[model samples]
Target: MNDVYRIIVNHSQLISFWDFAEQPGQEAVAKGPFPYRLTEMAGPIERVEDGPFGAAAQVKLGQWWNLPRHACPELNFHGKDAKLTVLAWLKRENIPNRGCEAIAGIWNETEKKRQYCMFVNLNIWDSADQVCGHVSAVGGPTPGYKYCMTSAIGSTPIVKEEWHCVAFTYDGQYAKVYLDGVLDEREDFNPYLYDSGLFDGGDDGANFTVAAVHRSNEMGNFYTGAIGGLAVFKEALGEDELAELCKITV
Candidate 1:
């Protein structure tokens, strides 16, 4: 596994939105004309269109929507000893309840049956001030493996409507969570818990996804808010690499 981590997308990667925009005679009527100004960011994200309110849709905290899982596609990182890092800028809405909800994570889907391989859920148990990070192994009739870690940040909470940087890094042996460039929590799991070819192996057809799950109900307790700057790294980033990522003002 390489120690160097790199940013895959930063708004500068978006290309043309014409391909994703509704055409003259398409199966579905256009929701609204494509907002050319929005695509000016980086690479075009499919299924996303300019909303009446603005560019990407803004979701309130604790409010969950299934919508089109494809809107935010999966990001794939390949390597056995790989360290995966997911970072995003977000603003939490001050909802009456802070129920547990997944901020974002990777998942697997086949038809209607959806399985969450890993995710973050907040305000579990309706506490309105608690959060938990969970990672699962396998899915099916057999009991799928699940491990969880909790933190107290949910209480004081970062300001409700400010840009907050949240990041999670998982090496083969441990998973670390960071808040605004600061180490917050860590969980060590049995590396053997994963079966051969589970993550990047060709058999499982593994892929990375962003922002929410394909099935709305799956996000049950957690999932509400606006998210941006979603970036994935193939390798575990060192302290310096993480600092650089946080320093990016754009």
Candidate 2:
């Protein structure tokens, strides 16, 4: 295993980690205590030999991975004290639509079941092409806005065709976004505070989705690029821990 995989697996709070080494048309197996597998959905994604890790999933707009909510109980993080961390190693690429990109989460905007999702270029608060940590404590938009406005938006733009480590975490107080293992600080933005905690999306809530989300009555916000690795934790990781995880080399 690579250093990144080893570090994540050793963490006590780790929920799941996907290395994206599986072949095309095969299920992406997650390694951890839960080991919940993600099924390829919508369309086929290529498995390329080149990546930050050994292999990667090269995806397009229509491709994604799905894990039914009920089937993966460990990923259903909620409640007043709920904490979470999601990290991904991705080679970003520009899409034709140029809309926000969803990396992973249980966010389902159509059903108002939004919880939390790691995103890029959310195009909100005068922000674009930056790492975003979208969180919803009410499963709907913030009181005065049409869209969910609670998020920690990073300052750095995600450059295309380059591998970068992007991540976000919630510590029951603030939602923080990180780029390349460091907090890409933006005042009142990178450490967006919301103490209400995560929303419990119940039994009929959203499914865990990767590279896309169900929004506006259809699947959209597709992340087009190569995803080399992904990991989820039940607790927010510290800055040093994230820095170490980003040190992995192919």
TM-score, every prediction: 0.52, 0.97
Clashing pairs in 2: none
- The most accurate candidate by TM-score is 2
Against the true structure, candidate 2 reaches a TM-score of 0.97
Q: Could you tell me how far off, in angstroms, the CA of residue 5 lies in candidate 1 after the best superposition?
A: 15
Q: List residue ranges in candidate 2 displaced over 4 A.
A: 95-97
Task: Write the residue-wise lDDT of candidate 2 on 122-196 in tens digits.
Answer: 999999899999989899888898989999999888888888999899999999998888999998998888898
- lDDT to native, each model: 0.38, 0.89
Please give the distance, in angstroms, between residue 204's alpha carbon in candidate 1 and its true position after superposition.
Answer: 7.2
Evaluate residue 101 in candidate 1 and report its C-alpha lDDT on the 0 to 100 scale. Answer: 49
Which numbered prediction scores highest in lDDT against the true structure? 2
